[model samples]
Target chain A: MKVKTVAEYVASGEKPEILFWVGCAGSFDARAKKVSIAFAKILSSVGISFAILGNEESCTGDPARRAGNEFLFQMSAIQNIETLNSYEVQKIVTTCPHCFNTLKNEYPKIGGKYEVLHHTQLIQSLIEEGKLKIEGGAFAGKRVTYHDSCYLGRVNGEYEAPRAILNELDATFIEMDENKTRGLCCGAGGAQMFKEDEPGDKRINVQRVEQAMKTQPDVIAANCPFCITMLMDGLKAKEKQDDVMVCDISELIVQSNGL
Target chain B: MTIAQIIFILLTIAVFTVAFRQFKRVVDNIKLGKSEDIAGDSVQRWQNVALVAFGQKKMFKRFIPAILHFFIYAAFLMTQVELIEIFIDGFFGVHRFFADKLGVLYTMIIGFIEILSVLAFVSTLVFLWRRNILKVPRFIKPEMNGWPKLDGNLILYGEILLLIGIFSMNGADVVLQKLDPAHYPDTGTLPVSSWLGPALFGGLGEGALHMVERFGWWLHILVVFGFILYLPYSKHLHIFFAFPNVYFSKLKSRGEMENMPEIMNEVKSMMGLIEDTGDMSDDIPEFGSRDIRDLSWKTILEAYTCTECGRCTSECPANITGKKLSPRKIMMDIRDRAEEVGTKIRSGNPEYIAEDKKEAGATLTIDNFDDGKSLFDYITNEELYACTTCNACVEACPVMISPVEPILEMRRYDILTNSQGPSDWLPMFNSMENGGAVWQLPDERGAWTKEIEA
Candidate 1:
């Protein structure tokens, strides 16, 4: 399997419709790597002309900026923007809400601007446009509940895209106690994933998992790589890992389509 | 002029002077903050004011409290009609001047206010019960320990006093009208006080009823004056600040933190993207917020606007999970420190010195008057680090205050200026700076792509 690079597309004097932004988690984290493969497979199945930055891709500096290091954030942002500008990347899609949010919202101020979309949004549009067909397949009657990633749902105000795909899958889509605007975080945001949790009675991820557990769903659907990792770790802590599966919306769609 | 009119004139002057002085203090305190450009977008800002403030849209999210709040709010507005008449009668030394002039229209207005007064009274009782008896979790948070707890109760008590005055005044007037139709004109019956008034004061003689009416009249106006004087020191100040605060709220997405131009320019220059103009100055740029002066004026305004509702804290994930971070506490701390620092700055400044201090010829030095205190003295490092920056607090705020903004600023000061942060963050920062990711495997960044099919 060969994933084409933006450089290769540029050398051939062609442009990709969308640049697949594989964030650190999607590229390196073992579990999130499966989401990268799933989303890439969907793009290829839909016959969409997309290319990855490959080695050219770097951290979007979201974690550093959130951690209060603006110098490091701009350093990574400026370097990535130069590469993006040189390649004349017009549009981008990512499996990580942190990357999508930073590139779409924070990049314009620092001279990096693009039509960025989350993978869920892209898949939703692809389904609507008849370019992609999703079948019930493996998850027909399985109960699914969505854990809204703060960056995608509340920050970017895109609560519908992931839910829309779930609705298309014919799964028994249930909602958690706190969903949408009031959705709880998986305790992985704000650079919490990289650092140890502050001394508290319980982790935020465990609390959020408890909320998801109340839904009693077979699948806990998430849109961000960070959220997926956090939810899985939460399930393990609750000893519900065997019963409940933590998966990305892309993975759910890939399984539903049997891609 | 009559003696009563003369006294009322003096009282009016005193009330206005006190209110003006206290409000001016708040304005001066807010001006101590650093200025930022949050201007333009007048249309959108006004829409926010109308929808969030005037419409009370967010309050309705919690059904029971919103309904109770609506009753009190409606009563407050309706009471203003009767207030205008009371003040006019005081100024002119006339009893029920509008009753004779406006005729039936005046009676109808008084009836409406009477009904609302009863509603307000009931609502205030329920609010008190919720705070004291039920002990709502939000009201009992550690932040509401002392002055905040007493302030919450005091506001409800004030409302009760106002209601009592309204009922007694109307009740005594109803009896006086029956006894002496000449001095007390027949304005028709008020809705609630008509029956309740006669039931309580009907047995009194004409002279006693007259005395009771005057006493009630004086009590209502005096309590109103007291509220005006006390508002600046109480959380009830939100009654005035919430409108302007919502109007000036940040219009960006909740997740978008303000970009730092100082850091951006320096980083660009360091990268050779921008020219090093050799414009170095004796004063080095400060990195982030250290004191009230280091924060933007909007944040200071938000601090004053906070009513200590604790919606932000209750929704805060860290607070829920038993971490020390409470967004409500952050706003309260900012307000408390602002008041402390603002007072010291004012008493020391020559231009804005108080009249009492001016008389002493106190030419005191203003510099270093903070006694080496800053925001960190109030907000601890443990609480600051506990924030996940999830924007739940930001979303929960009805008046649109962003607690995360100040937390970010303090964190920036901790890392950039003081170079102090959690030891755990050091490895992550190093990974990002050296390897361009938050992990050590830089070369394998694209290894996942190998699993993708063409």
Candidate 2:
């Protein structure tokens, strides 16, 4: 039960060179964990070995810092960096854009540094490397749209990797009216996950879900854990949960296994 | 007296009464605030007022509607005395018609602009309603219907009335030409309505035609004055407030809240409160932007001046995300609260307290922020944290309220003393602390920057 840091995850096994630091949202939240595990199992089936570095991880301070709470934020940042350094980590991959974002933009301020990959980005690279092949998903040929999580799309600019994985899954990605960088927030970001939203006329998540549904996607796939949570909740609010499915990009990537 | 004369005099009293009450109320309210007046004696300059108010600097950001709006506003405001002369000469005959050629020209121009205004009003109405019907998450998320949305319908009514009045008066002029072709001369330039009066008098009963002109003249004058009077009570108050809201706009600060002390640990310094000397630093303890006064005076103006355009609602990140927060609602809340509190303050109410009030070594904040735990007493704790501080609403505002500033000021208060923050923020920070990035050190921050091409 000793969850390795990204370095330890990287060096733990020699069979495959990739290491996934299952992001805080991915490790702690249920949907993200499911995607990480499914993606990991898919890699396992393909003779790739990877580790989830966050079994012992603490919460990332992206939420605290953005909210302007410097005291607890710095404290948490220091703790996470110490854990990873002890592992002598050299490389890491994560599924959360916020994780990708914090590592990319904010880590150097406090001195932590690591090579990070979003799982979709890693999968795309893996396929290009000839280590992974584009198998098939005899997808019902129903079109799906990928909702770009902001941290991945807008903040870190990982717009295409998830769609690439989805393409490999055999589902068509029709664009939402608002997509990519101009894409709307899923309402679950900005530390909104913690506090109760005020009662307004329409829930913000529902709006995004509605925007995606308007594309008539058979399923909505997202790269970030928060996006999935928000979209699914939006689907529920719409009572379209049965009609439109929400999943992480990795989950769609793994669905090709059944195909 | 002629029926036109009686109607004119009666309408005059009602218009003045409403304007007087609202104008008096505005003066009385400002007299009560402790904040230093941003607009001093120079605020009375005509060029400055017209520039700030009519130029629509804040509103032009919305692009199309704003341009249309600028014309309509200019037409309504600039053509005021022309309409006054129209009332005077149209019935009373004191201001000689022959001398006022400019008045006729001004009427024609505003008349031309009114045609565009009608389109603008309808388009803006359609835009907001479309957001509602489509349930654009940002538009409807926070608070809708708080300001008694009167802009769309009221503007439509006022524009329609102007059209009726302008055409009827012009129609009457045409009739006047026909009634005495030798006495009245046709200007030839007002091509649209030039033939109307002559045509109407030629066909319709001459007495009824004369009556119609009188009714149009009276109806136009009465409606214009009434709208001006009713502005303060309506969201359309922004028609007046938007100008002052921009001129005294908060120029972006140095990432610091005003009135914050330069040093927190100094002797006898009050926690979370300082008098406004403009310089602020991190070492200063900022309490919650507790009440109406603690906010910038322009922030207060933003409330009073909100056209309730719902642009903020349309752009809010949290509102779109299924969070119960609306940036629009926050503005409305501040608007309503300030009006409620400002009214009390203006009446010389003695129970007033600034956020600067000393209590138990900490400045007493207001119905905002925390009584015990959490930020914001008015909005939910979750809703408060829901803000990404994206500045979309600020950028989107046609009125220049800078909606993000007050929200950030409150966030600073929470971040400084209470250790309160969003649940997710801690996790990101933890990753930063231990691994030096959200992905942690083994996940390295520099790699993504290197990989992702700009």
Candidate 3:
């Protein structure tokens, strides 16, 4: 298992075709790190020339801006934009919807612009293009339900990509009652992941997971790391973690491919 | 001319004058907000108007309510034809003016209106049932208590009265044509009112029937005029404002928050990335909305267009989970605050200029008369922080209102302008500032790469 940094690619007098934006959660969160590894393995297995920013990558300031700290948001945005621009990176793929949304929608106004794709979207495209194959290596014929990450679904209108990935698997794919455009938030958006609940009777993730549990799924699939973390916590809260599992779409893909 | 004709003319003129004045005040109140450049893309905006407003596209998301609401909406439009005849007959002191002239075509039109009026009557009853008897959860929320609850019931009751006026007026006309054939023109047996007319007033003689017809006519006219006057004060203003509100809908995707170019320029200059072109003499505009005038005119217009339907709140994750953030309440707060400030400004100075346009010490702007109250007085910091910025409220809105924008603006005011926010977010902010991540792991961003590299 070998990974190439953008600096390494540059020093070798060659440039990767895509910059894998491992968002803050994917980089540091122990559970989210598996999602990063899974996504990277798929990219490498598919024979795509991609590299990580390594130490050069920074948070896209999505949470900062959402939490209303414009100064901090702008500072990080400018720094990240400078770094990406310096490397002349033209395309980016991130495993986190927060990073994907910010880089795709918010970056252009402040001078950072690139073709940004969520990993699920990229995987869907890869499957469409016949560049990648998923043979349902693990969790075959299992009941799976996908949770819609608000950032990826309503915010960006990309509800089909993750579901399309699930369609490739040899599994019984089910939908939670609140999926797609009407999907409920997983209590992790708008910087809520970094703070305590704001005095609510029920946590949002608990409500969302309850919707998934109603489907009686063996696996709850999510595209965003934040949503995955929150849903896992929700299963823990309900003491259903042993019976129910929360997996990122990339992790599912990697498992199906037996990478 | 008869005395009735003269009185009708005067009454019509007076109603128009009063209604125009009230509607003009709404326009002026909306103008009190900061100006925004929302021009261009006329074709797309008009499409939104046709589909969302005229077509009632989003309402159809819920099949039962959509069908019921469409019945009433269609009746409102179709009844305008009958209203024209009423106006002409009243002004000319005639009875069933179009009956003789247009003959069968007139019968067909009135008959159609009668059917719609009946449907509208039924729909209004159902709406009342849903609100009062069924007690829909969205309708019974904390914010819907008191005046909002009463206002909603009152609107439905008013609709029922208006429908009754339609039925009785047409019904008496039917009886009069048979009893006194010389004066009362034959309307050719209207579909609904013909059967209903005799059933309700068959016992009355010719003279009593004429008096009933006249009474019904006056009741309908007065109710219509009263609704016009009451619209500016009630949430029912959406009937008129929804057209323009949908036409000027934000063309951007829901995720795209309007970027503050002022902050961007300042940050660039501070970072030495660009030369400072900002005017030092000009008073820096408030970072975000503190009061009505701090918000954009579009937002103020959205506040006016909101029907207090509670769809936005019902879809809100925070509100559903028992947080204090109700998106419907946010729009209502903006409207309420704007109304308060607009009244004070109008009373103090009829020709009040905005703050940025006023000369130094002019004292003619809204700042002098707002009584030092801001949106914060009506909306709390807890409610603001509870939002997830999920855009569920925006998507759920039938009229294309985005409550998320105002919430975002107020949050900006709380954090950027006031330096106040949730205490738990301080470490996250510090981490983002110092290490470009939300956590304290500054040097560990790419640590996961080691596993793969090894």
lDDT digits (tens) for residues B188-258 of candidate 1:
98887789879998888888888888888888999999999999998999888989999999987776778
lDDT of 1: 0.88
Model 3 chain B worst lDDT run, 10 consecutive residues: B349-358
Question: Could you tell me how far off, in angstroms, the CA of residue A14 lies in candidate 3 after the best superposition?
Answer: 1.6
Give TM per candidate.
0.96, 0.58, 0.96
Which pairs of residues collide in candidate 3? Answer: none
Candidate structures ordered by DockQ, highest first: 3, 1, 2
Best by DockQ: 3
Which ranges of candidate 3 are over 4 A from the true structure? B278-285, B349-362, B367-370
Q: What is the TM-score of chain B in candidate 3?
A: 0.94
TM-score of chain A considered alone, across all candidate predictions = 0.98, 0.89, 0.98
Task: Tell me the lDDT of model 1 at A127.
Answer: 86
Q: After the best TM-score superposition of candidate 2, give how far the Cα of residue B334 lies from its true spot, in angstroms.
A: 0.6
lDDT per residue as tens, model 3, B1-454: 9999999999999989999999999999999988998978999999999999999999887789889999999999998888898899889998878889999999999999888888888999999999999998999999888988999988999998888888888899898888888888888978988899999998998888888888889889889988999999999999999999998888876777778777787888888999997743387556888889789999999999999999889989999999999999999999999998888786666345554455665655665444647899999988998988888998899999999899999999999889999999999999888787888874567789888766
Positional deviation of A121 in candidate 1, in angstroms?
1.6
Residue pairs clashing, model 1: none
Show where candidate 2 strays beyond 4 Å.
Answer: A1-23, A26-60, A65-70, A74-142, A150-171, A177-187, A195-219, A232-259, B1-111, B114-156, B180-185, B189-192, B195-222, B240-286, B311-326, B353-454
Q: Which candidate do you rate higher for DockQ, 2 or 3? A: 3
